[model samples]
Target: MTLRRRILILATAVVLLGAVGVFAVLRASSRAAEKDRAQDGGPRVTRGEVALAPGDGGRRIVFRNMAWGPHRDELATVAADVPEGPRTASGVNCLRFHSAAGTGICLRADRGGVAESHRAVVLDAHLEERSSHPLAGIPTRARVSPGGRLAAWTVFVGGDSYAGTNFSTRTSILDLRTGRLDASLEDFAIRKDGKEYRNADVNFWGVTFAADERTFYATLATDGKTHLVRGDVVERTVTTLRENLECPSLSPDGTRLVFKKRVPGLPAEAPWRLFALDLASMRETPLAEERSVDDQVVWSDDRTVVYSLPGDFGADLYALPADGGGVPKRLMPSALAPAFLD
Candidate 1:
């Protein structure tokens, strides 16, 4: 064969092999995705992560004399058999906590419904007296606002009834410095079909303020359905944006919102990775769709979003870059509610 013709044939063969290699890479990636889905068992949870400052010599939220492991899930759940805690997770010293009052360690019950409650007993960053917060009443859900200005406050207005979940509840801006409640006069109400529905069925759990601090978004749960609802902190009106989303978290800059989407193939309790939504054009996109990622989302800066997923074979904390790159890194066996302690 002529030398030039031989080179031409060789180049053609190389091209053909490159095409096959590309096809193989794509096929392998697809297979790996399928395998991940199988291993995860379902959709993952949307999550955000923040780093905490080693305040006062590595001070952390400490839970009371309770088991702090997987075994404790069913155990503490039993204690609140008829109860709840902060939907957001917190570490020891702070431990994870929630109260119907939203800020204190107490229980609030809706009328004619079962009485359920859980309190977090722990010291503050200053290590002063033991503090009380009510938002931790719900266990799997315990979260404090990114800004300390607004806090979940559960209180009974007139009758002996107290606030909990969706019952006439409002947020209190707690002055961690003065130990007083700062009130947010803005309107934070949810209306559906020209009516007001109150109860856990319409509970708002995922509540985070805007970067401008003018608005916030929360997740509303009704029966088994969940929706992402936005509230105009300045206007006091609630807008239902998306549905089937359980926990909605706002990015630091407030231009985007992250949440979890439910896929039909898995159980509701199955984890859901983070999703993002554009506020301007109202565009929605899936950022990271990991399985087994039960979320406790807190933004780390704007580009770097961190969240918690079950790790170490269901015994550790996993942190991933929100933008999606690299395998998740394990921080600790149980590092939750990780927020920038700055």
Candidate 2:
């Protein structure tokens, strides 16, 4: 071979090897990005734009915003301070607040890559994890009792009915202090119309604890009808209270209950209206927020109620008067599952 031709062939081989190295590097980077997204629940976003800062220790609020991507786990102030959307608990997809004790319940899902298995993680007042419990089904709700000694959660289980109007949920309550778990409400004795009732198709969800940790209110669905029932942890008994109520949240004062009630003539997708039921009078008063609120309402104070509404990018927290008047005010943008730290 000529010396020039030999040199040309060597140079061509070197260039081909360099190209192969670049391609390998690109593939590795792409895989790393995918892993980050999986861990963070979504893509990362720039801070100081749609992010809120974690405020001082006292009376803080924490929420999740999938739109914030890596900063989806966020902390803010009860006064609606700019949230510090830091990357805390990167694996927690859902979270809720225990206002009285200043703790939280965080949920993490492991579906191989999608959502299949879930774990209920207990978070301390400072947003640090304490313990986690393995759970079945997709996580939908998590709540801590007023004293924070007990925690409960609900997950949708069985069938593709969640995509449609009908669905089933398996709600569990954990005694945080003793680590005792009531895996399913189905095991509890239920009384309807002052008589013991047993049904295999019965399901319960959306539990709100009373001042006494042993007593709670939850939605019980059976035989194609939904009813609000008051349950006792000690007695392991549930008694039906009323009909057509879902996701009841007890008032901070313990005199009223805020929940979602189905309103006729609305589309099934957005069929609920926020209503306050007086415990003494049993009168249901509709709140001023006209939009469909598909959340368990939280009491910001005795006079104001807070909840999340879905937005274009993510869900935002909104607060309105608890007395059924006044417009709903936006509390935090790109935040959901508002839990006030007291």
Residue range 25-106, candidate 1, lDDT tens digits: 9999886545433132321111112123243423222222122332222111111111112212122333343221112221
RMSD of each: 19.4, 8.4
> Clashes in model 2: which pairs?
52-83, 52-84, 53-82, 53-83, 53-84, 54-84
Give the poorly placed runs of model 1, Cα more than 4 Å off: 1-92, 97-117, 120-124, 129-131, 134-136, 153-188, 192-200, 233-236, 268-271, 311-315, 324-326
lDDT of 2 by residue, 1-342 (tens): 999999999999999999999999999988755543424243333333211223454445556654544545543333334443332333345644343475578776656965467788887755567888887777778888878888889888765432244677999988888888899999999999899999987989889998888989999988877799999998889999999898999987899999888889987778889999999999999999889888888887789888888865567778898889899988766667766654
Q: Judge candidate 1 at residue 19 and give its lDDT.
A: 100
The candidate that achieves the highest lDDT relative to the unseen native structure: 2
- Count of clashes in candidate 1: 54
True-structure Cα RMSD, model 1: 19.4
Global lDDT of each candidate: 0.46, 0.74
Which window of ten consecutive residues has the lowest lDDT sum in model 1? 74-83
